[model samples]
Target: RQFGEGGAELFHSHRAGGIVLPTGTVRVEKLSASFTELPGFEDGAWWVQDAAASLPARLFGDIKGLRVADLCAAPGGKTAQLILGGANVTAVDISKNRLARLSQNLERLGLSAEIVQADLLKYEPEQLFDAVLLDAPCSSTGTVRRHPDVPWTKTAADIEKLADLQRRLLARAVTLVKPGGRIVFSNCSLDPLEGEALYRAFLAGTADIVDDPLRPGEIAGIDPFLTPQGTLRTTPADLELGSPERSGLDGFFAARFRRAG
Candidate 1:
């Protein structure tokens, strides 16, 4: 249902945040507003997640009943998305504590998934999945707008170390998918070294894998952020839809690939 006149006025006057995504995701652009205090949250009508962070899982068109592995999937945001899309998800993370939080979230959302605690490097499944999502660990430079201290907390060397780790985790994710299966690799770092450069290096070496670029109009408001090679790259400076205080998305990069049959 469309908003009534009064509702529309309120929504516009408050300058809410991002456009409503197809998935019904409503981004909270007002940084000072306590989103949790709003209605619908208590009923699990929504969950907290940066709009940019919510894009990678959506690269999978229709995952109904598809088996998906979510590597390094703690806090369960993407995992929850996949489950909502009707995918059978195995959410894996190394931190037991984080997995516990994920469990709580899933329960609150009335969603379910097979949760596992394991280091991605050593994780093994009895069956290969139709797809895998690797939201690898990174320097998290993309979120500096929300956490200004991020730039001072890490170094180039730290980024290099994290990039290497992401490369390995991505490689592992590829192995877990069956032939012709898809993989969406992503990280929350603005540096190309941890994103574009790293994926390119891996693609150059992996002959069995091929890029599966996003189709035009696949994601609403996504055209401005797409790379020429069809990857999604968003920075805090992108997505200028609101006031200067709430105009950009978090820095994130993501690419999709398919294994040769």
Candidate 2:
């Protein structure tokens, strides 16, 4: 209502809960400040987040009473979503500065979580969680449109390096969640070797974890993104679909796996 009238031509990511985006919107590409300065933001109704970026947190369905971990969580947009979705979240990140932003975001949203500052590989919890979200560090090629610096900053060697790091983080994330628990692993990279291929290898080597395919209508407008294995491979351009407005999303891949109990 307000968003539409504001000349932002936004789309509702879902009727239930999500940040409404101006149709064809990209992250941080400023819309009119009217929406931002409105009472909704000032009143802590919602925080800024990319629509595609929000999907990984939603992969763990109905985690109301479940304990979850946002491993490598900094600038905690997904952490807030988990908290709102009824999961008790332990947000972990390596950087103090990034954690500080996450803390401030949570506070503004009137949400709360247990915050841990430590490296994902080195950090160990006394008990594992029921679910975990790992939005790993990547080459950022998928985010080139929103983050123009990504193309200039990342290299092929960097992609390989990040892929290796992603594997390490996924391995650690698996250990942090209980058997039968799910790990939603996501990376903002378009490379198959980095995302799809790497996860396929992880599945081959690890017998206990199995791929959990996403179903149609589970997440609105998700059909085109599904790969044969049921993982999600999202591109920035998908949302536009010939829309007259400028639209796109960061390249991102997400997969869900549940450990064998």
RMSD of each candidate relative to the true structure = 4.1, 4.8
Q: Residue 220: error of model 2 in Å?
A: 2.9
Residue-level lDDT tens digits of model 1 in 84-171: 7889999999999999999998886678999999988998899999999999999999999889999899998999999989988888
Model 2 worst lDDT window (10 residues): 1-10
Q: Which regions of candidate 2 are displaced past 4 Å?
A: 1-30, 34-36
Model 2 Cα lDDT, one tens digit per residue, 108-139: 77789999999999999989899999999988
Model 1 error, position 260 (Å): 1.8
Query: Cα RMSD for candidate 2?
Result: 4.8
After superposition, candidate 1 runs with Cα above 4 Å error:
1-24, 29-33
What is the TM-score of candidate 2?
Answer: 0.86
lDDT of every predicted structure (CA atoms): 0.82, 0.78
The pairs that clash in candidate 2 are 9-23, 10-22, 24-247, 236-249
